[model samples]
Target: MPAKLTILTNGSIKVEGDFEVCDPQGGVFNVAGKPAVFLCRCGQSAKKPFCDGAHKTCGFTSEVKASA
Candidate 1:
């Protein structure tokens, strides 16, 4: 299975592949081979770590490159 990488405009890193998401509370959210994962970068997400589309309002953009 190939990993899917996506670069969003005015948003954080949206990774869609075999990965895991962990919070500061020691909470782990396993993707189990998901198709999309939004990572926070604006440092103002109410969801923390995970992006909740707050970047649209904050105008936060990521300069990440997509790779297969």
Candidate 2:
């Protein structure tokens, strides 16, 4: 699938396969850098880049796909 990037409804960005998530403090976040990760968009997640289901409680929804 060449590493899929899916933006779910009222949820974080679903990232699969291979990628890198670097913190603002110059730190790389990776739990072995193998498992799939969900990045937060609503900014209400307790797990920072990872989603903690806080988007649902904040009524967040994103489904806009820009065409290239």
Candidate 3:
């Protein structure tokens, strides 16, 4: 399936389908064999690029909508 990215309000970016997460040096994140993953947006996640539900207590606030 094609990858789909959903930006959650005041939270992480929910990712589904086939995709890959990599760093600048081309080191890839281990999302292998997983159906879905949540990427951090609040920067409060102890898991770095991945969300650890830290936004719930970090006082983060954001609500974005796509525009075309």
Q: What do the candidate models score in CA lDDT, each in turn?
A: 0.74, 0.82, 0.95
Q: Name model 1 segments beyond 4 Å from true.
A: 2-5, 24-27, 30-33, 61-68
For model 3, residues 1-68, the per-residue Cα lDDT tens digits are: 99999999999999999899999999999999989999999998989899999999999999899999
Candidate 2 lDDT tens digits, 1-68 = 46788888768888887777788898988657466888898999999878898999897877767689
Q: If both were scored by lDDT, which would come out higher, candidate 2 or candidate 3?
A: 3
Among all candidates shown, the one with the greatest lDDT: 3
Worst 10 residues of 1 by lDDT: 1-10
Residue 18's lDDT in candidate 2: 72
Off by over 4 Å in 2: none
- lDDT for model 2: 0.82
Backbone clash total for model 2 is: 0
Order of quality (TM-score): 3, 2, 1
